[model samples]
Target: MTKLTLYNNLKTVRAQQKLSQSKLAEKVGVSRQTISNIETGEFVPTARLALLLCLALNKKFEELFYF
Candidate 1:
């Protein structure tokens, strides 16, 4: 069986937008550690949180995450 792994360009996108972890977290109602965890692939956000992040980052779902 083949497993799907999720990957993201969050760090790069976040850097390009000049948003700090704390700032983005504030916008998404999460913690800096949560953002860090997502960036490091240590956690997968809930679907609602993912959409919130997409809105906060001005990115589409595909732009934020992929398999």
Candidate 2:
């Protein structure tokens, strides 16, 4: 099985959008630590949450995470 790694372009995307972790968390309905964890590749988000993140970041899902 392919190990699922949490690969995130969150920091870059957030910077591009001029959004802080708190702001992004609020937009995505998650805690700031969740964004931190994702950005640090420490926590993999579920499909539902990934969709939420992609929407909040205004990015395609593939642009956010991949194998």
Candidate 3:
């Protein structure tokens, strides 16, 4: 089986938007650690949360999440 490497530039995007992890997490209804984990590829968000993140970040889903 092949391990999937999901790479996301969440940190970069967040910085571009001038949003702190805690602020982004609050907007997405997740803990700051959760955002940190996601940024570091330690966790994958649900579709709903993904949508919320996209909406909050003003970025397309593709821009936020990618392989």
Backbone N/Cα/C clashes per model: 0, 0, 0
What are the runs in model 3 whose C-alpha is more than 4 Å off?
Answer: 1-3
lDDT over C-alpha atoms for residue 48 of model 2 = 93
lDDT of 2 at 56: 84
Residues 1-67, candidate 3: write the lDDT tens digits: 9887777889999999999999999998999999999999999888898889999999999998888
- lDDT winner among the candidates? 1
Off by over 4 Å in 2: none
Model 3 backbone overlap count: 0
Cα lDDT of model 2 by residue, 1-67, tens digit: 8775557787898989999999999998999999899889888888999999898887999897877
The lDDT ranking, best first, is: 1, 3, 2
For model 1, residues 1-67, the per-residue Cα lDDT tens digits are 9988888888899999999999999999999999999999999899999999999999999999999
What C-alpha lDDT values do all the predictions have?
A: 0.94, 0.87, 0.91
* TM-scores of the candidates in the order shown: 0.94, 0.89, 0.90
Off by over 4 Å in 1: none
lDDT of 2 at 58: 76
lDDT of 1: 0.94
lDDT of 3 at 56: 95
